[model samples]
Every structure is written in structure tokens, then in C-alpha cells.
Target: MDVSKIHGFNFPCPIRFGAGASKELTDYLKANKLSRPLLVTDGTVAELSFFKEIKNDLQQKGFSVEVFSEMHKNPIKSDVLKGGDAFHETGRDCIIGIGGGVALDVARAIVLRVNHKRDLFDYDDLIGGDKYVTEDVPHFVTIPTTAGTGSEVGRSAIISEDESKKKRILFSPKLMARMVFADPLLTMELPPFITAATGMDALTHNMEAYLAKNFHPMCDGIALEGIALIANSLETATHRPDVESRAKMLLASLMGAVAFQKGLGVVHSLAHPLSSLLDTHHGLANAVNLPYGMQFNYEGFEARFDKMADAFGLSKNNGNRVVDHLFEMNDRLGLPTKLSAIGVEAKHIEELSELAEADFCHPNNPKPVTRADFKNLYEKAL
Candidate 1:
């Protein structure tokens, strides 16, 4: 790796690794001097046996712990407000964000608004105001149950706005979790399709970050390794359902999240609006848009894609092989291959294209995207 090619980058995060690492959560909190904590997670994850063990451990450690599980799949401003109010009412000094991205994002927003002003939209990066984040945001820890989204290590939270009908990004380094616990055991029971979709989502993150116009070798290296790991383990993890595969998948997801701190591209930009308009699962939406984005960026990323092929053990000219592989992987994993297959229609393309072009992530893509480009991509995906 030529270190000279990359410059001006900052990476910050503490990571706890391996299986059964989640058992050390209370010790981590105590080491950081947090005694009162709120466990922020979704209802489905809260019902998992993993959360049961976590709840028992926190209580046994003599910490005052409260649960807040009202966050939605695509969290909204109202959801953040509710979560912040819950944190204030509980008088928690720390937050334990568990489950998937939605829960972690909610936890970040809750901490952001804990003792601050009430207007959640004021804090959104798209709203043209100063960031609401402060160093006083609660001590936070994250444990992700799903092997996608990578919110455990991410510094940004995505939420939907009812009025705008689009997803908004809220970013702050202060919102980063103090500790990120990657425990593969918690992901063992995930359904095959969910595993596949989330794995593809992680792959998309790595691809987009690598293709983004950013000067960060560390993030680039991380993205390459993340892509390789997903290539090596996604299929096995989806079909075998073993601890080792699960562990690799979880690590890959975290790596993807860490890498994308550089930026994302058209896939995520296009997927976000499609998800909002069609009620598509976030990961699945990314999966459907992956190939289209790859084709769009093909000319610009030929050399990079070839390098990625080398890293993933593909032939020299097989630069775009991942696209075909992703389609096959989606079919094997029982996910939708096309937008139309998933119920997205031509009628929504005009609106979806305009919103996708307006997306913040669109500018970071390796290839410049115009409204016509977005419309074509949407039509191609369908």
C-alpha cells in the first residue's frame, strides 16, 4: 500500500471484539464510571435471549437500567423526541444501544437531545443549522445484533421526516458510542434472507466508500478488507448458520461501517428514497440498487474494481464480477432482484429520481450523477 497516496484523515473509535464480548458490557460501563443507563433497542431485539442476558447482567451489577423500545424501523423525528424524553424521565447517565441500526440511531439522537432544545429537526445536517451535539451527550455503548448497517461504529444517524418524505442525516462525532461491542453470538438466529440482505448492505457500504472521492488510505484499506471479508463469508454465513461465519460477517459489517466514514455513493442515495416511498427494507433496497450503481460507476472505478477483484481472488479482467455475483447471491438468499419484483412501479420513478438526485450522498459518487442519470438508474433497477 502506498501511504503517500492518502492524506488528511481522522479515525476514532474503541472496539471490543470476539464472541461473548457482550458479557463485558457492564464492566465497560463501570470502567467509564456510568452507573445509571438506559437500554435502547427495538421490541423485537428486546425479546431476544441476548437482551435477556444483557438485562440480567446490568441489573446484577447494581446499575439502574431502563428500557426504551419504541423506535420504528425507519426512525422519524418524533421517534427521536420520544426517546430523548424517555431518557430524561429515566434520569439515565448512560445509554446502551443494542439491536440494529434503527436502535443505535435512536440512541444517538436521544443522547444528542437529552438535555438540549426540543426541536429535533433543528439538529439535522440537512436543515442548515449548527449541530446540536455536545460533549455532554451521555456516555454511550453499542452492541449490534444484525450483521448490517454497522451503526455501532458509525458517527451518523439516518432518520425519516414525515413532511419532507425523505431520509435526513444527523451527524456528530460526539454521538459515537464510547464502546462498540461486536459479539457474533447475538447474530446466530437471524433469518437467512435478513442475513443475506444485511451482508449485501455491508458489501455496498464498502464498495461505495471505496468509490467515493475521498483522500483517506486508512478508510480505503478498511473498505477493501471489508469487501474481501464479505466475499469470503456472506454465502457461507447465510446458508450454514454457524458461529464462525456469523462472527466473520459481524466483523465485516463493523469494518464496512468504519470504512464508510469516508463517504457513500449513488447506491445508498438511490436506495434511501426508494425505501421511504416503497416501504422497502433498507438492506434489500441497497441490494437492488447495487448493480445499477456499479454499472454507472464502471468507467471511473475500473482500476479500483480490478484491485478489489484481486483482493477477492477474482481474475484480472473480472472487475465487475461482483455485480453478477450479487444477483446470484440475492436469488440464493431469497431477496428481490428488481424494483418491479419488489412492487416498485414506473409511476414512482419520477419522484424517486428527483429525491435521489437531491440526496446528500449523490455528490460523493465516483461518477457525477444528473437527474437524467438517476431516472435511468431507477428505470434500469426496475
Candidate 2:
């Protein structure tokens, strides 16, 4: 593929693609001049036999590798600190982030603290609003076990605060992984519901980025293509879980991450708080909030949305059709439609709305959303 033909997209990572490319982990480590590498993953993925294959290979190559599965799902600040302690204790000079978003986030934070002398909160872009003090932390390689989150290419890590229910993002270009290995085989074990939810999350990334009021054509084209791909393949992949469908979903996720570099809007803003507060699955929260944001942004970018609707094969002209299609998609995929259906309540609306409005993604929304607008959306979504 002539990557330049895709307009504004550029990925600096040395990405290896295919079903079994994960077997090349040892070769990649050698190529990158890494010897002792700490493998960071959550308890869930660490328990899988697939991870043991890579672990044993590194051992045979005389590359000291250690496993840390103490990572949390939402990835608390303490988790990163603990991971940092392990990195220091083992004298590991490189990191292999080998799980989902939480593990990836922890790995990113651990690398930063290895050489720098600052509290994790101090480096947070959300709270401290400070630029990350990026030194050469480690040569990091990310291998995503799931086809969601896109933390492999993301330049920020979301860590929960010390005493708060909210999560904060630590940002820097140096936080991006040095290499990413996209192996479709890893996604084969994913359950149908997770596949549906994560695929929808990727779709939301493309949709929100395309709808964002930004001037980046590169992100726009990537988002459009990503959205189209997800619409076409998500259902098939969830039901079938074959190599072809898995490859398409994985590629869609990569494209979604690249697309959202332009910006994301209220869907992410709303979803973040839901994940923090309700402990709902991140992708499911995004799925529930997506339609409301679509309706809200429709008037501001009807033409762009019209183009998207056509691309998604909707016969109608605006976001309403897109919203209807999403509802149907959710139903087919066995996802809950309303917040109430997912155990959220009317009482929680005020607090969630306030926090959501303050979320970083709010300003990038194509339309300005007020507290009332948020409450109304929550009520309607409920």
C-alpha cells in the first residue's frame, strides 16, 4: 500500500502484521537492541497459554523476561507505581506491553517514571495540565490481545487518581510504543459480546473523529474508511470469529486509532465518566452514548453526516438514520440500549453530566453541549 495515498495518516512504529507474527517477538527484541525486557500484562491475559509461548521463547534466547500480572482493569496510579518498582527491581531496560488498554497504560507510565523523578499525578495532563517530562524511558513494544482500545498507537495513558473516582490522561509523543505487532490469532478467543462492544468502540472513534470540527484531512479519510469497514464487518466477526473477520476487525481498530488523532467528541467524554463511576465496560458505555451525541452533532454537520450515512449504507440523509441503525446494531449484537438497562439510574445523572462536561473531549464536539443538554441526553438515553 502507498501509505501517502491515504492523505494525513502516518504511523512511525515498525508494525508487523499477520495471524502468527507474535512468534517474531524474540527477533524484534534483538533487532531493537533490547536484552532484559519486562513483560507487562493484566491477570486475565497472563493466565492464557498463548503468553507462555512468548515467555518461554525469550527465556531460551537468554533474554531475561519477567511477568507482572498485578495490573488493574481501570489502571490505578498505584498500579503504575508498582509496575515501576518491578522494573527497577529487575533491572529490565525494555517493556513489552502484552495485554489490553489497562496494561498498555501501566507500561507507558512505568517507562516514564523509570528515569524521571516526579509523582505520577504531577505528570498527568488532566490534573497537573503539565507536558510530560519524556526522557528515554525504555524501548517499548505493544502487542494488543484485543482488537479495541488502540492504546498501542495512543500517546496518552489513563490512570485513576489517588483518592478520586475519576481517571486522568498522561500525554506525550514519547509515550507511543516503539513497535506494534498486530496478530489476528490473539483476537480469536474473544467472546461474542466483547467483540461486539469493542468493535462498536472502534466505530465510535471513526465516527466522532469524522464528525469533529477539525482541519485534518488525513484523519478524516482514515475515519471514513474505518467507519465503513466496521459497519460492514463487525456483525460477521462477532458471530463467526474466523481469520478473515478477525483481520478486518483488527485493521479497523488500527485505522480507528489513527483516525481519532484529529480529535474525538462527546461520546468519549460521556463514556469516560461512565467507566469510572459505574465500572461499566468502556466500549459498552461508548456504545450507549454514541447515538445521543450523533443526534446532538447532526445539525452542525448534516452534510458530513449525510456522507457518512451513505457510506454506512443508510438510505436517509442525517444522523437520525445513523442513530436508528446503531440501535439495530446494538440489538443484533446483544448490547443494552439505555443506561437504565445497564444498571444506571436517574439519580446518577447530575453528577455524571457535570463530570462529562468537564471531560477533555467535550470542547471538540461539533456542537456545544451544556449541562442541560447532557442531562437531557442522559434522560433520553435512559
Best by lDDT: 1
Which pairs of residues collide in model 2? 8-218
Question: What's the CA error at residue 324 for candidate 1, in Å?
Answer: 1.9
Across residues 70-96, which tens digit of lDDT does each residue of candidate 1 receive?
967788888888888888887888888
Give a tens-digit lDDT track for model 2, residues 82-162: 888899898898999997777888888887778767877788786654565757778888898777777888878888875
Return the clash pairs for model 1, or none: none
lDDT of all the models against the reference?
Answer: 0.83, 0.82
Model 2, which residues run further than 4 Å from truth? 1-10, 127-134, 315-319
Best by TM-score: 2
